[model samples]
Target chain A: MKKIIMEKEAGRFCENKDIAKKLREEIIEPTIREKEPVIIDFGNVSGATQSFIHALVSNVIREYRDQAFDNLLYKNACLEIQKIISIVYNYMQLD
Target chain B: MDEKWVNVNPAQLALTAALALKVGKENAIIQSQNIPLSARYLDRMGLYNFFSTPSPFRQYRKKEPAGRFVPISIIKNGDDQSKFVTDIIPLYHLSEKNSRILSYIVGELVRNVLEHSFSEDGAVVAAQYYKESNRISFAICDTGIGLWKSLQIWHPKTDKEALSLALTPGVTGTTLELGGTSENGGAGLFFIKSIVKISRSYFVIMSGDSEYTLLKTRPDIKNRLYSDPFKDHYAFSNSISRFNGTLVAVDLKLDSTPEFQKLLDDIGDIYDSAVKESRRKPARKPKFI
Candidate 1:
C-alpha cells in the first residue's frame, strides 16, 4: 500500500475554498503520480461544510470515474465529516 | 414533471431526510412525498407521535406508476411544514451549502424547543431541492411547548416577545438550559440567519403569533461588506401568541420576483388564525410593558 499523509495544519479546513484547484496541485496530482490508493486522515481537522467535501471527492472522482469513496476510508474519521460527505454525494448524484 | 408525488406526512419526512442524505434530491423525491416509514425508529422513543401514528395498515403499498407528476395530497391539520419544503425545495445553486444552513438552523431550533420550552416531543423536519422549479423549501412542526412557553425563561411576560427574541439571531437560550458552550442562548440561529442571508433565500420564522422574514438581494453581500451580528429585529412587531409552539418555512428563490412582498404577507396570514385561537383560551395572560 502506497500511503501519503496530507496535513491540514491550518486547522481551518473550511477555509479551503479553491479546494479543487488546491487539491489538484497539492494532493490528487501527487497521488496520481504514484498511482496508488490513499487515506485521507480527517483526525485533527477542525470542521468543514458539504461543499468543501464535494470539491474534494468530486474532483478526485472526476480524475478516476467510478471510484468509490469508502475505498479510501479513514476508519477513525470524524462522524461529522462522513455525514457531511454522505449528504453531498447523495445529493450530487441527483443532478 | 417526470414523476408523481404523494402528499407528505411526518413519517415520510424522516425517510426523506435520510433518503435525501443517501440518494440524489430528485430520486429521493420521486420515491414518495407523503413518504411512510417503518415504525422501528418511533418505537424506540415510545411517545405517541400524532403525525406518525399509522392509520389502518394498507393491504399493500401503492407503488408509484412511474413517469408522471406524483400527485401530492394535501395533508390537512398537521404540522407538515418541513415536509412541504422537502417535497418541493430546490438547492441546486447552493448545493450542500443550503443543507448546512438548514441542518444548523434546525439543530438549533429543535434544541431550543426541547430545552427551553420543555417540549416533551420532537419536531419533524423535511426539505427538498427542486432544480426544475428553481426553489427549495423546508417546514418544521412539533406537538410540544409552543413558542411562548419556551422563551418564557428570559422574557417572562409574553409568548410573542419570547418568539420575537428567539428569532433575533444568536438567541442563546441554549447556555441557560443545557450548560453548553454558551450560557445564555444558542448561537445557532444567528449563524443560520447569516447563511440564509448569504444564500439570498426567503426566510420566514413563526413562533406564537409573531412572524419574521428577511431576504438578501445580493448573493455576494457577505463578501462585499463587513456585517453586524444577528439581532432580534422582530421585537418591533409587537406580535403575541397563545399557541403552544411554532412552525417555520424557508424558501429559496432561483429568480427575482415581483411577488416578494406578497410572499411575506401570505405567510403572515398563515399564523394569523392560529395565533388568534391560541389567545382566546383564557390561559395565563401576559402583561406587556
Candidate 2:
C-alpha cells in the first residue's frame, strides 16, 4: 500500500481535467494494477473543481468498476474538496 | 451637468455614477431629457442615496452608501481577476467553499473576456454585498463585439438566438479549423447557468439588442438539479437600446449554506448525461435547458 499526496504531485489548485487525467494515468493506474491499496491524500490542496475530480475518479471507476472503492482511499479533504468528491462519487453511482 | 451626460448610454451612466460616488461627490444634480437604462439599473441595484426629482430625468443625489457596492477596476487578465476574488471574499467574509465557487465563476468569466472578446480595452467587473439583505451582486462588462456578431461567423443567428445558444454547453464559436483546443468545451456559460440556478441566484445577461433575465425560483434543495425550461424562471426579451458588448449581472443570497457536494454532484451528473447522449450508439441529440 502506498499514499499519494495530490498537492505534491499537482499544485495547490487542481482545476483542470486534462491534468487530472494525467495524474490518474501516471500515479493511480500503476498502483491499482499492482493491487496495492492507494491512499490519495488531498492535504494542502486549496481547492479542486468538479471537472478535475470527476475525471480522476470516473476514469478509475470506469476501469476498475465498483472494486475501485476498495482499492482506493481518500484523505485530508477539506470541506470544499470533500463536497466535490461526494458529488463525483454520487454521479458515478448513478445510472 | 453637461447636456451630453443626459443621453449617455447605460454603460456610461453606470460608470459615471460609480465614479461620482467613488470621488466622494455623491450629491450632484443631474439634468436629462429621459431616464436612461443606467439610472434604472442604479435604482434597481440600490446604489447611492439619490432620487429622481419631479422631472423624470432630473435626479438629486445624497452622499450616502445605499448599497455596499465595491468598486473594482478593469480586470484584463488572470492576476486582476484573482485580486477581485481576494478582495471580495474578505469583504463578504465568505466561507472557504463559497470562495472557491466564486473563484471558479469569476475565473471562467474573465478568461472568456481575454480569450474571445477581442476587446482592445478588456473587461470591467464590480461587486456589492448587502449584508443586511443577505445578498451579493456581481457585474461584468466588456466593450467587445457582441455575442451575436461573434457567433455569427460560425452560424447566422439573431441577437436573441445567439444569446440563447451561448448558454448551451459544447456550443463554441471556435471551430476545429480555428485552432480551438479540445478543452475548448464551451462549458463556461453552462457551468455559470447551472451554478446560478442551483444557488437560486438572479442572473441577467445583456448583449447587443437582446437580454435574458432569470429569477431564481427553486429552493436550495430541489427534486431536480436544473430548472424547468418552460418555467417563468427566465425571460428573454429585446431591449430598446443595444449594448455594443456583453454585460452580466448576478444577485445571489449570501446566506446560502454551502451544499457544494450536492452542487458538484449535479454538475457531474449533467456532464455525464451530456457525454452519453452525444456518444450513444443509436444516435441521439443531447437535451439542454
Chain A TM-scores in order: 0.64, 0.86
Query: Which residue segments of model 2 deviate by more than 4 Å?
Result: A1-42, A49-95, B1-68, B153-156, B176-180, B218-232, B275-289
Report the CA-based lDDT of candidate 1 relative to the real structure.
Answer: 0.42
lDDT of 2 at B33: 61
**DockQ per candidate, 2 decimals:** 0.03, 0.14
Candidate 1 at residue B209, lDDT? 54
RMSD of 2: 9.0
| lDDT (CA) per prediction | 0.42, 0.62
Worst 10 contiguous positions by lDDT, candidate 1 chain B: B177-186
| Range of the 10 consecutive residues with the lowest summed lDDT in candidate 2 chain B | B176-185
Off by over 4 Å in 1: A1-95, B1-96, B174-185, B216-242, B253-289
